[model samples]
Target: MTQTAAQAGRPRTRRAPRRLPYLVRQLGTLVVTLFAITVVIFGLTAIAGDPARDILGQYATDAQVTAFQQIHGLDKPVVVRYLDWLGGLFRGDLGISYQSNGPVWDVISPRLGPSVVLVLFSWLLTVVVAVPIGLYSGVRLRGRRDASLTFLTLIVAAFPEFVLGLILAIVLGIWLAWLPVDSTAVSAGGLFDSPTAYVLPGITIALGTVPYIIRLMRANAREVASETYVRAAVLRGVTEPSLSLRHILPNAAPPVVTALGLQFAGLIGGVVVAETLFGFPGMGQLLAQSAASRDAPVVEALALMIGALFVIANLAADAIVVYVTPKLRDAVR
Candidate 1:
């Protein structure tokens, strides 16, 4: 009777916390993280030099510079400017771009699609190519195949991303002539119309990212394979494929999923370099041009946008991890 009573009471004692409160806490953390990012973005502007001078040019008279500063609120103190900017953001106004004299969103909106496409293509391709090879390599650890694969990953990792881009551009775009040399056509035509334009850049990014993911997956798979549950399954005579796919893969996936979320965020920086190289009309290209022109508003908006994405990516990764891991789901609740 006592055993039955204790068993019945266990669930009540260990019941998961309310899901609403858990979500509310996550949202609060996201808001705090985004606010911190905005502060850092504004802080960077302090060292970006005088935006008024940059916009007005060195030959502009002092009176003209003062008028420009006054018009753009550049003459205001940093704190006031930050508050005004924050208020504008709350109102969905990203401010006018110094380079284009247009709403920053207008400039950013068109370029957003290309970057999204590139990131999706690159991430998906990396996962498709990396996951199977990584899992196989892990299952075959210490063999000649593993050594060769590891060596290749190291070789690829040794090259800078741009270097890899250059090589791909030369070989595939020039030598084989299989894909477009640059993404300029994609900018002129829509992505669907110039799908080939994505190929080189996408491959370049995939090659750059794959090595890290492969190594991470391999490490994770090996660790998971050694777990007691896996050993028990092995002793019970589970087939290799079932053991790897059913038992090992599921256990190994959580960290990889989190890494993938971070990898997506990290791709923003890589996209900048790739887009600039390929002449892709994306946020990356715009960011380079805006920074070069000292377009502070555009630059600041881009920085904050990227920072927000980073925070959101982490939150997303955490959510996915919690959803997939029963222990994590209960603990987080």
Candidate 2:
């Protein structure tokens, strides 16, 4: 009453603590991580031998090499080059690709589609399927159902993504001749050109993801199911499934959501292997080819882009957590 009366008498001096779950900390870490990525990527030039050699070849005369270096600004100090590159990055220029002789973004932009389609499809499928199965498995923890699920997940997770993709390619592409062995299906015309091409890649990514999400959800559900509220719900004539859906699932969401974010971010890298196996012309494929060709600018841009994506994914997860948990939302405020 006193506090309320005082607030009415004057503006309340104490504001609710400004909160947004872990957004502030995550943003700070993201900044530091991005900066570190820049530094590391820039430092790679030191070990890149010489751009003149990579670009012009050893057969070129010293005069030709010097001219090449000057024209491309390769002769500049590392810090100066990095600053120039960083400035260009902010202005939506990813620099010129040494290999393609065009703007890096222009070269990489078209390839972005396949990676986006593949990852989104994979992530959506993973969540849609894993969440329900995990919930059921969690409800049946330690029972035959859970045991079977655990074993199945183990088998799927045991194979590396590339291995699974390879086996699929051989079986679907070779033995049965059901799908294209290569990724020409997604080339140039986009995913609609050959929707079937997406099925194998999507399934490959899904197989890798399902096991991890299943494990996270199952563990979290079990922990939530054991909580007092769920126990009370069980006592009140509520079935385990109903209690799980109502009382346990929501409470178990934070960790699962967090893991999902990490998994999504990880899929960016995973697609590199997938693209390699499937021969899809995505950012992952471009990044691989650029790295091999010693196209430093392209590599740097691609690495930073992926890093930025990871930051975005983690931020999204934090936002979801803040929106869903009322107690957490209030505490943050």
Query: Each candidate's TM vs. the true structure?
Result: 0.84, 0.81
What digit string (tens of lDDT, one per residue) describes model 2 on residues 1-333?
999887789965688666554667777878898888888887885468567776778798999988877876788887798899878877988888777778888888888888899889889989999998898788776777778889999998999998899899889889999988777668857467887777777778888888989998998888888888788888899986678788889888778887787788777767778887788888888888888888888888888887788767766777677767787777666
TM-score of 1: 0.84
Worst 10 residues of 1 by lDDT: 12-21
For 167-277, candidate 1 gives per-residue lDDT tens digits of: 999998889898887788877877678988888878877887799999999999999888999999999999999999999888887788778877876776688888888
